[model samples]
Each structure stands twice: as structure tokens, then as C-alpha cells.
Target: MQIDFTPDPRLYPFQSRWFDGSRGRLHYLDEGDGPPILLCHGNPTWSFLYRDIIVALRDRFRCIAPDYLGFGLSERPAGFGYKIDEHAQVVGEFVDHLGLDGYLTMGQDWGGPISMAVAVERAERVRGVVLGNTWFWPADTFSTKAFSRVMSSPPMQYAVLHRNFFVERLIPAGTRDRPSAAVMEHYRAVQPSAEARKGVAEMPKQILAAHPLLARLAREVPAKLGAKPALFVWGMKDFAFRPGPTLPRMRTAFPDHVVVELPDAKHFIQEDAPDRISAAIIERFG
Candidate 1:
């Protein structure tokens, strides 16, 4: 698939990097030169999601944000499944290829599972973790299941494929503050065609189809990386991944974790509270 989108330099003024992993070529941002912080993104978003955090923290931390294959400026290779497990696999290869001896992991949305999967494998090298509105267990809640089913249904899938529903509708609804027209267009331009939106469309289905992987992470993450310091920057008002249940479940895995509650922010905490989130990261993992 050909993506004709170039990031606005004023908004995303960083050098772009690429990694040719086992899966495909991935576009990433590697800025600053201190302790590395790997930023993993979620559905319908890309490295672009972390632009603010990277700008704020890059002065003191080596901020690395990668666009997973089939998203952002990454290549959408033919025949790729675009499954959660596949994303984890590709990210794992990216980590190994980078030879990162020690780094911090930060993830939100699907990023939580995918980044943690990498951390679990490289537990010795992972010094800490930062998580936001996301999950790594079998998503069996009524709301989760209902959302997955409805979004994966034919009509919703069609809307996502043709109309860019996630970027147009969910991205706005997920954040307390609406994104600017430029920000929305940056997202829309990347996945302008049905072929480019394949990864975005596959994720809703993966919520159910990837349960076994989630189940594995539920066990393995706590067992292996529970000792690592954890920070939960939660968006309390998030429609999905509500703090009431989700935060406690995460605490069960990281009993010694620190929590930074964002009462007004929603699912896309990166968008709504990047400055606060950056401050918390510097305090906890600086």
C-alpha cells in the first residue's frame, strides 16, 4: 500500500528512523540520548500519538516510538495478519534488532499487551513500565465483549474500512479534548484507503481472537516482570478500561505500582494529558 502522508514538521519535528525487522519495514522516532523509553502505540494511532510526550521528555530521555507495520509510515506487507500476536512478534524483533540492553517500556491501548510482551521476554533489560488505559488479560467483560462484537460486525467494519470510523469517531470520543483538524487529518491521511486501514479493522476482532495470547500474558507478565517498578497513568473517565476494574486488575500484577489518576482524561490519555503524563514518568522513572 502507498501512503502519501508526510508529517507536519512543526507538530512532529524529529528525525525519522526505520527498522527492517522480520515482519516488514517500520517507521520510528528516535530522539534524545539518555535512558531509552520505548513508546508502543495502539489501534488506529501510530508514533504520531506520542509526539507530545517525546517532545517533552526527549531532552532527558532517549525516547523511541515506533509505528507498527501496517500503521503510520510503516509498510503494509501483503499477506500479513495484522493480529495482536503478530504485532508483538514484530516489536520483539525490533527490540532485539536495536540491541537495547536496558530501557523503560510505555504502552497504552493495545500497546499495553504488545509492549509488555517484549518486556516479558527481555525482563532483565526492562527497568520499568508505564501503562495507561489498556489490558493484557482475557477481555471478558460485558462492555469489552459488546464493543468488540459491535465494532467487528459487518456494518461497523464497513464504516471503519471506508469512512475511517476509528480516527473520525473514536479518537475524538476517546479524548476529553477534541483533536485539531490537522491532528485528525494526519491520522486520516495515513490510512486513506481500505488497504491501509486493514490493521485498524483487524484490531476489534483481535480483542476476541487473541484471547489465548492475552491469557498467556496475564500469567507470564506478573510472574516474570512483577518485580520491575510500574507506573499506571490512568484516565479515569475512559469509556473502555474503566479505572474501577482495570486499575485494580493491573495492581494485582504489579502490587508495588504507582498510580497517577487523570480524572478528566479519557482513553487517549496521551492526547489529553501528555504534560502530566510526562511529569509522572520523569518522577517515577527519571
Candidate 2:
């Protein structure tokens, strides 16, 4: 019920900006000046999810991480559509507004689709991609327990956003290493208000709908991306997108891509193993 607007010290000294005035204010941290790197976070997390990577990569590459509408410090409009296509459009507009060209992209969870959409739609700007614990394929069968709940019972929405139980319980459980009290509190601080929760609450339905856009993206992204230097950093221990299930699909899509499996990591690979993940990105892209 309480929201902490305090900015993280680690995220300080970076310029913040907003775009797509009518849609919602997107709070983004932009730093350094070089080939750009856009970092996108998944559900229940925000730009803070990419904090360590931003710090590690900013010195050599221009790093930009935006809190999606209805998450983090971003404004949550009462009736905004949080569907995949809309999120992808916002990403496209944001990149166009910033005039970013020939940059690398890193994505996780929902970010996986959004970033791929951007690359498929705005190919000229994206040079490479770094994927972590996510999927871009269409699936009729739900994969994870959390996803199965969402698909089976509509009431699960209340448990996730309204009650905050899902965020409180699932996030920490999915991590290989329990996050520090401070980090856990930081994650909770951005909890959406009842009205603002609509965006997140609607995610399950949207995902279930398997909007044609996602299917289109799934088919087109691999072809568009080709062998453009991709890095697949996966968490073998992730309960949601288990590597056994998704890795082969990803490998098929990106045959020439480099793959690294972090056996000790979980869904939040960046949080669970920041140093190793950062080192891998720098080694590949720096």
C-alpha cells in the first residue's frame, strides 16, 4: 500500500527523460555516449531490474533502460492498454524519439517480445540482441505454474496485482539467491495502485489471447535478426522458462548465436548473477 519514490543511489548521475506524452510518462535512465544499448525489463519489475548491467555497460556503451508504463517511476494512466502490441509500439516510439541508431538490445520476460518487435519493425536501429530467461514463441499450453494459474482461473488476477501476494511470494522464490532486504523492499515499493493495477491485471488475458501480433513477431523476429551477433544468457534453474523447454527453440531460431547457461541462476538472471551476466555482455559487445 506504500510507494517509495526514492531513487536508487546506483541509478543516480544518469539523465532521466519522458516521451509519448499522451500515452504515459516513461522514466528512463540514459548514460554514456557510444553505440546505444537498450535494456528492457519484464513483468513485476522495472528499470531497477537492469541496474547493475546499466552500471557495468554504461561506461563503454550508451545504456538506456525505461520503466514501462504502469511500472516503476513511470506514470500509470487509468485506462492504458498494456497489451504486447501496445508495449511494442511504445518501445518503437521511444526509440524513434531518442533517435537511437545501430544499437544493441537486451531483453527479459515480456521484454523479449517487445525488443524483438522493435527489431523486426525498426531493424535499422538494432544491431545485436541479448536474451535472458524468456521466450518469443507461441504456445497453446501454459508452461509455468504462475502462467498456468493465470490461464486456468481469471480470479488469479486479484491475487497478483490487487493483493500483491504474487509479487511478494513469487519474485523472491524464483531467484536462486534470495535478494537482500533492501532490494526486496525496492521491488515492493513500485506496487501498482488498485486502479493502476489494471495494466498488469490484464496481462494474463492479453497473453492468453495470443494476439496475432505476437505470433507475427515470433515468426518474423528470427528471420529479421538473422545471425546478427546475439547472446543467449539463460538461467538453467528458472522455474518458469526452463532451459530444457525453450533453449532448443531459441537455438533453432538463432543457430549461430552464442549461448551461456548459468546453472545456479533463476528467472531474474541479472539479479541472481549480475557480475557474470555483465561480464558476458561486455565480453561479447564491448
Candidate 3:
């Protein structure tokens, strides 16, 4: 059942639309006109993450950003098994149900892998990819493992389960520009309680646990990733996936693709450099 989405018009102004998805009623923003542009967000975030981008590009493109099964305004049923593969499957179901073939895709954070997974299944359907601060490699690097351990610690779990720190602090911290008070409020308000934040606990842990899945995706996704137009708009200031690891691996993955790094931005480039991102999308895949 849809719950607690008192939309702050200044924040997420778009109308909420739903799809009778494989995982119940999936909520999305279907706006504007022309070729479809699919924006996939990551953990602890929803379609709302792409609100700015949607508003920026909706004039020329049909922007469809969906909240995953247990995210945003979507139904987060108990014991939903929020796995990587399952998330990828629903994306496929979402596009298929809408009969969208030959469209654009943009992914950030966990949205990166999810879009790649969807591309594996629906390559022919995808026109190109807007690769933001995200990667597709297995979580085996020293940097990745270290991030996983820190995130899985007792303090972290307490923050996620009780304090709603992931939504409150981390998302804002990821942005170099620092989102406004209203923006941050809407971010936290979407998942107002502990129960609403269940997916938060499971989502990041997958980065640690999905090595096998990532390995398989590593082997399979590369063959198809470069088949379409790919533009890598990276946030160079990202602490998690900076010069240490994520960016390099992604660089190797899409060697031929265009990469525009934003030194001013952090992990959440969407918040920091939405106009630049939107411009890149228009130039490369518009």
C-alpha cells in the first residue's frame, strides 16, 4: 500500500504514477514527451533522486524514474528478499510492461549495477547509458571491502536502523554542494520510520555479499555495455569511489565511452552537477 508521501511541491514536484509491476504496484514519474529516458537510483534513495534531472530534461524526453519495490512510494512488503538480481528483474519487468524498447538509461550508486543488469537483458531496448558515479565490478577490491566492513559495523547498523542516518546524513554528505534543508527533509520524510528503512539495511550489504553475482555480471555485462552510446559523467571528489578504485574500473569497462569528470562534485553528482549531467545526456544521447 502507498504510504506517507506528502509531496513537498518545491522538492519533488512531479505527479506520482504507478505500474502494476512484477513486485506489486511500482511507483514512477512518467513525464514529458519524446524518447524515453530511464533514470535508476540506488539504495536509501528513490525516483526522487532524479527529480532535478527529470525537471531539466523532461522538456525534450520522456523521463521515467521508478522507485524500486521497497523504495520511495512503492510497496515495501515484508520479506521481499531485496537482492541485486531481483532488483534488476523488476527493472526489466517495468520496461516490458510499458513496451519501451530503444530508450536512454542513467544510473548512479547501486543504480549503476541495476542499469547494467537491465542492459544485459534489454540491450536492444536501450539507446544509450548515462553512467554517473557508479561501477560494475565485483566488490573485491581493498577499497570496496573496507567500505563494506565499515558500513556493516554495529554503529552503522544502529544508524541505519534507528537514526535514519543513511537518508539524513550520508546522502547530503555525498553531495559536495550540500542539498538544501527542504531537499534533505523530503529525503528523510519518504522513509519516516524504522519499518520504512528495512531496505536500507539490506541494500549496502549487497555490495559486500554480491561478489559472486558481480563476478557473473562482470563477465557478461561488458560484452553488451559498449554496444550502445555510453557517457561517463564522474564525480571526481567522491570519497568512496575516487582515484582509489571505482572510477578506474569504470574507465576500463567503458574505455571508448565519453567520460566527463566533475572535480567540484562528490558521489552524488546528480545533486552537485545536474545541469552538466543533463547537458552530457543531451549531447551524447539526445
Candidate 4:
């Protein structure tokens, strides 16, 4: 199935606008005024990843899910740096520009670290956190042979962005059950222009498990989170962060939090088990 690059009117009905003088034109869905529930997505996915969740929760809580600058409807500037710090800064500006204070957050995959950075910097603005198929620590959960091979190969970068090999091969292989054709198509459609693909391509090359920044962030997050109401929803079948390592770390870090593992689901828990996950979020936050 081929992805559609043209914006979907149904998915994005609101008028998209630029924030912080065209750093990017952010795509956001704002509805039913109240304290915001910010939803952050991971790599290769965008605000579209939260469509079902947004539909499920918008009536009860104000939903604010933005496509990170390089991901979805947001502008993907050519030759831009897509480091963790850069992403965190953009998220901070995105939230602050709207004057969102004391809002809850839902994060998955890369969203986990990015949102934590936001919460750490703007603790006063965060009321709660929900983690889905994500991790904070640089544990040995993802040192698979395939992953290691890609990490070691310089050619992997070219395969990922230029050829879409990462999405075409790695992502599907990581899941126990293949994503629906529609969902896969949507994921493929969001890639930015060729010039903008530099950041997208370079992401895998930048991953270094022993990086000091990851360690520092991991150490700081647990202390910062404290006993704030948190929800950990996991997909046991996830290949990247399997139950053995990921769940234990979460349990160790957040002993008091609620943790649910859907044995049949995969890494993209929201896509594979949307109804169940959405219900869990509603029960916890509603």
C-alpha cells in the first residue's frame, strides 16, 4: 500500500499554524476546553499516531498532540539537527506558546524520553504521565543481532531514509503481528522532503547506548517523577523493549504506578490494541 503525502482533511480539520516565528508549522487538535492532555509520539510516526486516542479522549479532556518538527505536518527544515535536545526544545516551545500549565502527558517510544525532558524542565506544568511501550534507561533490552548489525554499518543510514528500508523491513519484522495496510500506509506518508530527510536518516547513526546524556537523563527522570500518578501500559510482544528488561526497569523506577501488559500486542500498542489502551487511559485519567 502506498502512503498518501497530501494532508488528510478528515484527520486534520483545524487550521495549522506556525509557532515561534516559523520554526515549524505545528499540527494540533484542540477540543473541549480544560487542562490539556498532551500526547507525544515517537520516531517515524506523527500526530496521526494518536488519532484514535484523540477521538476517544477529546470530549472529556482537552487533547493537544503535535507532530514533532521532522515528523508529520510540522515543517522539516533541511540541514536541521534532530538531536534529543533539539526535539526537547521544540516540545518546550510548543507547549509554552500555548500557555499550557498543569497538563497530563502520554508518551511512547522516543516520546518517552522527549516528554520526560519536557516534564523535568516544566514540572510545574505537568500534572500526570502515561507511558506506553517506552523506556527511560539504556538497558540491554535492545541489543539484538539485527539492531547491532545496523548500528555497525554506515550503509544502514542510506537504507533507512533514502530507500525506506527501515520502515519496510525493520519495523514490520519487530512486530509479532503485521500492522494493518491502512496504518502502514499512514506511517509511510509522513516522511518529509528529500532535503528534510537528513535528520530522519541520521537518527539511527546518532544512537549510542553509552552516551552520557542518556545516562544523565535516566538518573534524573526517576527522581524527578517521584510519586506522581503514572500509568505504564506495555505490549509484551514488543521486540525492541521486551517485557524482561523494559517492565522491570519501569517497575523499579515506579513501584507505585499501574502497569498493564497486553501479551498479544506489539510495539505499536496503540495501533494493535487501540480500544484497550484508550480505555485504560480514560479509566486512569478520566
Candidate 5:
């Protein structure tokens, strides 16, 4: 899988692997050799988001992180609907294609719903779960509903597709320890064109459009995965998924759950406190 852009090797030092699954050629990183831990990413980011965690725990854990089609170095096919349910379907296919079993699932932001959708479907194969500032239920709150309406508006949609709003603004806004210029470029370069950013643009719409899917997840996730050992590493300062109702829902869903709150960290906990997240994963599931 040849990407048009080159990531700063210093920041993303891992071999690129390709999975020609049912959808298309998907880009992913498969590192280390142990009990597999599937790392699922959210919007505007890719497998690159999990680089530090992969490097930190590759020695003991098999880290398999894939870029959903239309998001990273993966091939974005024409006419593909970049919906959350579609992404989950593709991820589930990717999981089945790889024949992964007895693995821990880790997700943040949109990654939570996407990967958990996969986990619930393959409940027997999964071991433990790790989640961070993310939600899997319908957007009913005033804040989230307002956010969806604003981001899904025509002007904001244009900004996301044409101006690279998520990578340029949201990414930095959501993180406490800001990413460097070079690191930011890696994000920008992945979706350099408006056509390339269709996936990015669609996600904001999914916040509203994917209500049915999210509602199903809310019911199914707890019912299927409530007993699994879960770790919640929350970024307390995240404006989007703030320390509020979402966390409580997670607690209710996963009874055997440990909460590690990071007061300093923001939304992108993988970026803000990868070391702490890595340490917590090692302590809990290592």
C-alpha cells in the first residue's frame, strides 16, 4: 500500500500492512507478536493515532490497528457511504478476515462504538475492553445535538471537506498537549483533497444520521459485553465527551470496570497521555 504522503518516521515508526478485505484495500499496522489487541481509531485520524501505544506495548501485545476506508492511507472507493454502521461492518469483516480471537479491544472517540460493534458481534473471541473519551449511544443531549447540527450544517460541512477543519481545528482543539507541525501535516496529508475528505465530512452527519445504529448499540453492547473486564481511561477535560452522563452509562454497562481519570488530558487521550494509557493497559491487561 503506497501512500502519497510520508509520515515522519520519528513519529510513526512502524511497517505498513495492507488488508484487501471485502470492502477494499485497507491500510493497517500489525506490530509485535502476542495476545492480539485491536486498536480502533475515530474520525479525522487513522492508525497513526495509535503509534505511541503500539511502540510502548508492542513487546507484549499484538497491536492491530486499521484505517477505516476513506480515513487513512486506506483506499477510499467511489460511492461508498462513510457511515458509522458501514465502518463497523467493514471492521467486522476485517476482523473475520484476519481470524482474530481472544483479543482485547481498545477504542477512543468514535472508535468506541465502531470497535465495540465488532466486539459484541464476536463476543466469544474478545477478552477485555479499553475505552476512552467516547460514546456508543444516540446523541440526545443538548450539547451533542447542538454539536451535530452545527457541524453538519452546510458551511461547517464545507469547512470540513474543503478547509480540513477536523485536522486543522478540531484535532488541536481536542488535545491539551498540542501536536507539532510535522505531526499535524501527517493528518492533513492523508486527506489532502475535498474528495478525500468525504469520510471526514460524513462523520459529523453521522452524529445525527446514525441514531438508529447508536440506539441498537446502546441496547446490545451492555447486554452482550457487560461482564467483560473493562478499563475506562477518560480525559476529564474533553469538551465534547465531558465527564458527565456518558461515563455513567459506561459504568452501568461494564460492571467490572476500572476508571483512570486524567485531569490534564483532553479528548485525544491517545495523544495527550499515551504513556499513562500504555501503563494502565499494561497494569490492567498486560
Candidate 6:
């Protein structure tokens, strides 16, 4: 079944904008007005992940949240590469296409690297960045690496496609907020079929594969971002990212960037701590 890409003002509270650019039809929310704040979400989530933050900040800042090509309301056309590098490239194009200047980027999960990559590629356009529960370097522990391998395997494909394991089970497992049934149902609706769910499996596979370009990106993006205003908000309870390692590495990597740790929050920090996240974005960028 084809997923709905329509932007419902009541459901999303913003006009949906689409641009084919060179890649394809990408869905995004452009709300309010001022310096643009580009919000990028991780795997298995979309622009909807930033719903509350957008609602809070739209009055003061122009919020732009895009569903990556494969996820959310974007067109998941055939023959597209959903690897981390491809994602970052698409974001760069998206920014250029819209002519966003001196904007701020806020990304979570896979968004961390993608947004940072764009900042590195086009430093002139990005003024600052807010990274939440995300990683610029690899954060895999022994167990986590083992888990990623299994989840990216063929067996997990069946789980993601046939059973909704990625959204219904795994995502909530990583969060303390325990998203409501209606919210989860909305997530499940986006990738209602196996074909559309192909990206659900591909992203983890890309992470597990750890493409060489990602290693270069990991090494390079941070250096470029260090010169910009950056804020790090960590959900300390995130076992998937492991507070023990990723958080400290983040602080050490950019010693001067502001950091906020929410002990109660988890991997999906937006669900667990949208208010704090919103406040931090405004504090850092507003």
C-alpha cells in the first residue's frame, strides 16, 4: 500500500512543502519565520519527531523539518541509496534548493551526522547547531554492535515489515516516555508495507556496514562544526547510545559547547524531554 505524503494542517499544523530538487519529492515543514532551524530526525522517525519543538519555537524561529527521502511523507522512490552519506548529500541539496542562509540545524540520531555533514559542506549557510541524543563518532559497544548486526539482518527485515518491531517495540523500548498508542499508530502508518519499510532495515545495515565515507565524515564534520555555536543535549538514560561513552566523547570533542543532561530522558529525547529540548534550542539559537 502506498503511504500518504499529504501534509494535514490539523495533524501536522503546517503547510507541507515538497521539492523534487535533483533527488526526488522530499516532504518538509516550513513554519513561522526568521532564521531557519533545520530539524533532522533519525531512522524509523520523521519530521513528526520534532512536532512539539516546532510548536514551541515557530513563533520565534522559522522551523524546517524534512522527512528524509525514504522515511515519513517523502517519496521512497526505487533505486535510491539510503546510506548515511546519501542522506547528508540530500540535506545539502535541500538546503541549497531552499536558499537557507546562516541557518541553525537541530538533528537527533542519524540526523546528528547528516546535519553536521551539511554544515561541513556549506559552513557559510549554517550559523549554529543543536544536537540531541546523537553521535558524530561511532558509539557501538560490544553488545550494541552485536545487536545492530542482528537487527540489520534478514530476520529483522521480517520483523520490521511484518510486525512493526522497529516502531512499536524497539523505539519505545529505548524511551522512558512510552509514546502513546495514537502516536505509535501514526508512525506505523507511514511504512505500512514491506516495500516501503525497506529503509527500516537499510539504515541499520548502513550503520553496521560502517561505510568508509562515514568514517571520513566522522573525522571531518566535527572539526568544521567546532567553529560554530553548538549545543549538546543528552538523554542520559539512552542505553542504545550508552551515556557512558557517547556523551562524554561529545563533551570532550567540543569542550566549549553547552551541554544538558536529562537523567530521566532516553534515546528518543524529543518524546521524553521536548520542553527541555525546545528551551535549549531557543537558548542556544534564539
What is the TM-score of candidate 6?
A: 0.94
Question: Candidate 5's residue-wise lDDT over 179-228, tens digit each?
Answer: 98988888999998888899989998899899998999999999999999
lDDT by residue for model 6 (108-186), tens: 8888888887878887778887888777766357865777788877778789778878888878887896787767766
Candidate 4's TM-score reads 0.88
Full-model lDDT for every candidate: 0.92, 0.78, 0.82, 0.71, 0.91, 0.80
Best by TM-score: 1
Candidate 4 clashing pairs? Answer: 102-125
Stretches of candidate 5 exceeding 4 Å from the true structure: 1-3
Per-residue CA lDDT of model 2 for 1-286, tens digit only, reads 1234776685444566667555777788888777899998887788888888777877788989988887777877656778777777787888888888898988988888888888888776778889999877665554543474564375677676677655688788889878887887777777746655555665556665545876887788778886678899999898878888788888888766888888899999888887888888888888
Candidate 1: C-alpha lDDT: 0.92
**Tens-digit lDDT string for candidate 4 (1-286):** 1123665567544444446424555556665566689888876677777777777777788888877767776667654577766777788888888899889888888788788888888876778888988766554434743564574376776666677665667557656677777667666767634544554565555455324556766887778775578888888888787788677777776666888777787887777676777788778778
Where does candidate 3 clash, by residue pair? 102-125
Candidate 2 CA-lDDT value:
0.78
RMSD vs true structure, all candidates: 0.8, 2.4, 1.6, 3.3, 1.2, 1.8
Query: How do the predictions measure up, each by TM-score?
Result: 0.99, 0.92, 0.95, 0.88, 0.98, 0.94
TM for candidate 5 is 0.98
Q: Return whichever of 1 and 4 wins on TM-score.
A: 1
- For model 2, what is the error of residue 257's alpha carbon versus the real structure, in angstroms, after optimal superposition? 0.6
lDDT of 3 by residue, 1-286 (tens): 4557677878778998888875677889999998999899987788888888889899899999999887888888766777888888888898888888789888898998888888878877888878787777787668778877887888897888789988878887898867888888777877878787877777778897877778877877667866666788988898767745665666566666888878799888888988988888888877
Ranking by TM-score: 1, 5, 3, 6, 2, 4
List pairs with backbone clashes in candidate 6: none
